[model samples]
Target: MHLLIDQGNSRTKACLYKEGVFTDVVLSELTPTDWLSIKQGLIGSVAAAEQQQQLQSLLPASLAVRWLRSTAQAFGISNSYQQPEKLGVDRWLAILGAAALYPNQSLLVIDAGTAVTMDWLSADGVHAGGWILAGLHTQQRILVSATAQVEAAALSLHPLQPGTSTTAAVAEGAKAAVLGAVQQAIQLRRIERVVLTGGDGAFIQQQLNNNAVLLEPKLIFYGLARFIDNN
Candidate 1:
């Protein structure tokens, strides 16, 4: 079985893929012990070393372990960015997965998690670059931090129409800013297909125009797996 590990800022996701289909999935906070436990059955694995050393150690010596590094190697995508390697692996993987699923079509990928990332890749397999912005909670914290007197309240996913109070205004503003940033990216890139992923994808998807595809959260994982398979 192939183990795919995605170590992000908040959590680590591990998935077992047998043949070409995922068989098991696990999500846990970044902890060495947790990873080691999950590594027991993994024959081969891929991850960022700094975030996956424990898991790597648990694997058999014969098992292959590959670390994902930012690279300029064309994953069949034309990169329009001035510094393509400077892009995050998560973003690259997302775009790669999007392209693999919808090749030769202008596409936009929006991942709404701790941070919202909007990336664009041409159908012709070119990375046209993208943008990133703070998530709802992050944006709320920024507002409260910037203004000591303003109190930030919990953000609700209720469709925002108008703010009824100051706290609601802050929540609405945060949502609007994030959604607006994503919408702007889509417009600027002239993307034809929009794929939404991440924890808050559904919430953000609801706020967006009905032109986006709500993809499985494992879109990046699928992309990474495809990258490994092809390379």
Candidate 2:
């Protein structure tokens, strides 16, 4: 059994895996006490370097823990980054899951969390790289910062239409920025599918007009699971 943790920007999620699947999942903050309580078990974390180091220090000296990273190549997919280490483990693992789950499919993997990322992978297993942008809340925050009038808390996931108020305007603008990028990518290529995941993945998917898009919130964990299986 292994304790798998993905310490993302906004929150930390941990899960238990045995054999090749997740037996349990616990989403919470990654704290000193949390990692300290695990007296025994193989632990793995895909997180920022600092958080990983802090947690490693709190673990029992005899226990085993490994920090996951993106290598030059693993699990059949080639990383597009010239320096593979510079690429994010979360994105790399998600690519692994996408390749494993949808073989020979051209895809655009969009993760919309604290930030919005769109990665393109060709049908023949080539990672064409990706783009990153401000997340919905982040966009609203930026707007609020730039102008003193509107409140950041006013934004919401309203329908994608003309903005009737300040809140609607900010919310729609943030969503449009993300969707516009995805739509442009879809228009530019013969993308077979768009796999949306992350904190606001479902909300973004709902506003999209295309049937090719899907919301798979647990995609990151599934990708992590693939990495663990190969090890």
Candidate 3:
């Protein structure tokens, strides 16, 4: 079994993959103890370069690690970024994963975890670029920190109707900011499907009403596998 790991801002998803198939998936916060105990025997692993370095430093010296990277074009998708390498590997992998899942289909891939990110992929596999906005928790913290009197609000999807309480108002604002972005992206292009992932993906999908949606939290790993295949 090959060790597969994807490290994100808050946690890392680890699993065993043999011949592109994953088994025994695990999720753990990026704690020292967590990294120190990774199973040593595995064919190899893939992750962001910086993350890979950090992971390797905590593993056996001979462990094989492959850094996931962004390319100008792959899996039929042409990246529109002027400097494709500047694009986040997570975003790049998400785009690759989306195109592979729905070839020839227009998509707005939204990952709403640490930050809310959306990448548009044309029907013919051209990445039209993407946007980054504060995620639910991030946005709430920003709002509360900026306004001394504003307190952190509980996350509950409330109606768009006017909020009567201070906490409710803040909650409503954060909801609007995120939900609005998702709605706008759906209407911005002839998006055939909205690919949602991340912590808030299900909430976004619930609010989307009548739109096709796919929730795959492990998209980056799948893309890593595909990228390894074609490159």
- The Cα error of candidate 1 at residue 11, in Å, is 1.3
lDDT of 1 by residue, 107-203 (tens): 8888788788888887778677778889888888888889867778786878766788878889899988988787677678677788888888888
Worst 10 residues of 1 by lDDT: 38-47
What would the per-residue lDDT of candidate 3 be over residues 36-114, giving only the tens digit for each residue?
4543332122345686567666555555556556779877789889998878777888888888878889999988887
What does candidate 2's lDDT look like per residue over 26-47, in tens digits?
5344355645554334333445
Candidate 3's C-alpha runs over 4 A off are: 24-53, 229-231
In Å, residue 82's CA in model 1 sits off its true spot by: 3.6
Q: For model 1, what is the C-alpha lDDT against the true structure?
A: 0.71
With a 3 Å backbone cut-off (N, CA, C), the pairs that clash in candidate 1 are 77-125, 78-125, 78-126, 78-127, 104-123, 105-123
TM-scores for all candidates?
0.81, 0.84, 0.84
